[model samples]
Target: MTFSLLARCPETGRFGMVISSSSPAVAARCAHARAGVGVAASQNITDPALGPALLDALARGRSAPEAMAEVTAIAPHIQYRQLLCVDAAGRTAHWSGERILGTWGVAEGDGAVAGGNLLAHDGVPAAMVAGFAAARGDLGDRLVAALRAGRDAGGEAGPVHSAGLLMVDAASWPVASLRCDWLDQGCPIEAVARAWDVYAPQMAAYVQRAMDPREAPSYGVPGDE
Candidate 1:
């Protein structure tokens, strides 16, 4: 019922994800990431705890794959979980349990990785990998390209209702955290893309301001307009 891709660009050191699902608002439940921390996506009976767990483990100096492997190895119901990760250093990892139902798999290469379960076909993850490899841009753009490829390859087994994307830089703030919980009407994936357009610049401004206080405008001034 869901498919997701998480990645980090080596040259830019940017991290992001593109996820879609027949389930409504898959974004709120599946996507979890923090600036200067790491990226995580857990779906198909999502374990929200995994978000913080993965990050904490990474913060403890574990590599992305090691953290993910440690976390997944002991999950009470490991067979049902599908998760992916890319730490701040650009390491990548993913898992699709063998006991999972219907078209479950994951592919990792270079600076990117994608995972899915209950997909429309087996080609989705591969298409996503190819898209990421072919994309020539920042991490966020490469993530979008991979998502588009998955969708073009044929998304989930049924209709999509919601989608989301998340990305964070090494700094304390984000460049974008675009999420659309309900998109049963319009194309959810495209809606997410549009939201990214609307929010990217603003988030960038916020990140920039946080990075350099001089770039931020002073609110209370004698001649403030």
Candidate 2:
């Protein structure tokens, strides 16, 4: 019912996730990240708490595989959940429980991992990792490219209604968080991509507004003009 990727930009030290699922508000439950810590995705009977728990271990100096093992070991229903993690060092780890849905698989690249359950084909996850590795651009563009490749390879067993992208940089807050929840009309992945297209250019400007509103560009919002 879900497909997700956790990636790190080795050059910039940025961490991000791109995910889509048949469930509404999937990102709210499945995706987690911290600026200099790591990223985690908990899905398929997701235990949202597991995400933060894994990050906690990573922050405590554990590697991604060790953190994932510790957290999932303590989870009550681990057999029903799928988990993935990538630490600040770009070390990756993942688990697809025995109870995971049909045609599930995992793929890993230089600084990324892709995984999915209830997929139309087993090759989907591999295609995603390959696409991300081959894409030429910033992390955001590469993420969208991976997502599009997954969709092209045949997504979930059914149409996915929600999608999201989350990116954390050097700030305490996320530099980008985009979502398309319960999309009954358009493709949720495409919706998120469109939102990213509009947001990426203004991402730095937004941070500037928070740090120094005087120098931030005005966009004619209310009193700004």
Candidate 3:
């Protein structure tokens, strides 16, 4: 019921992930990333702790594969979860338990990995990876592109009601975290893309304000003037 991508931007050393699901608020439990560590997605049965555990391992100098191995071994009821990760060095790894949902798939690209369960088709994950590779602009942009491609290729077996985009740069917190927790009618992936379009231009300004308000740009609203 979920599809997700985890990636490391070689150009900027950033980490990001895009996820969508028939389940509401999927990202709230599945998407995780640390500024200088890595990005991870824990789907399928959805064990939220696995994402943070994976990143903590990456921060401790484990490669993507090593982190995945350690987590999957220690994680309880591991035979039902799907996980993906990309470390700071751009190394990627993925795990699909034997009991994964219907028509699951996994794919890898230059610096990204994608996985899906209960998908319309197994090709969705590869299409997402290809879309990420072909996209231009920031890591967030590429991730949105991947999500769109997954939908285009046949996303979940049923319509997705929730979606999220998460990214982390040099800051301690996420530079971009957008979500459509539940959409009763429209497409959540498109909704997230629209949100990113509105947020991307102001992302740097927000960071500047957080780091040093004196040098940051004005709010530009009526009250600020």
Candidate 4:
């Protein structure tokens, strides 16, 4: 059982996703994004390849709906997977197979989409979309807010053990990839949010370091000084 949101920031051309699940390492399997391409989630019976396949289609100039159609047409065992996508153009698409788990729901908003299976209520996804629409700051902030809203609306049918946040901008790689693979005691979403709070202020510095180390900020460690 899992819930996820995919979004694009029109102001900055960034794509992001936040996902949580009752399983371990949920993001490693379900979360997918590519800079200048799109973001995707492939869950419910979990076809990890589908995430990449959807992005590949988008990178090749397919719209979100077209990519979903193409992948579902060729993907094996398609009846068991739930898929979501948002292209660079901010167009969104999703597919919930006939065999998707219980109480599944999906909602789309301006430049964003949310979905979940085995959910506490059908409104969870809609709550996430609304939260994203209302929040401010960077794409990561809005994504985490959406995730919190889903939790408040009653998240998965059971306790979620893993959560993740992924984001990409103009870089060839993700600018943010934070994960709580497994949390035995507390909520993984909260864990991920705390991690984001710590990471967000430093995110730009890390990008600068990658792009042009000489102009990057100090590492604040003794050796760097």
Model 4: how far residue 147 lies from native, Å:
0.3
lDDT of 1 at 42: 85
Better of 1 and 2 by TM-score: 2
lDDT of each: 0.79, 0.92, 0.95, 0.97
lDDT of 3 by residue, 1-225 (tens): 999988999989999999999999998999999998999999998999999999999999999999999999999989999999999889999999999999999999998999999999999999999999999999999999999999999999999999999999999999999999999999999999999999999999999999999999988789994
Which is the better candidate, 1 or 4, if ranked by TM-score? 4
lDDT of 2 by residue, 99-187 (tens): 99788989998889999999998889999998898899989999999999898889888999999999999988899999998888779
For this target, which candidate reaches the highest lDDT against the unseen true structure? 4
Over the stretch 112-166, how does candidate 4's per-residue lDDT look in tens digits?
9999999999899999999999999989999999999999999999999999999
Model 3 vs. true fold: TM: 0.99
What is the C-alpha local distance difference test score of candidate 3? 0.95
lDDT of 2 at 102: 82
TM-score to native of every candidate shown: 0.88, 0.97, 0.99, 0.99
Residue 12's lDDT within candidate 4 is: 99
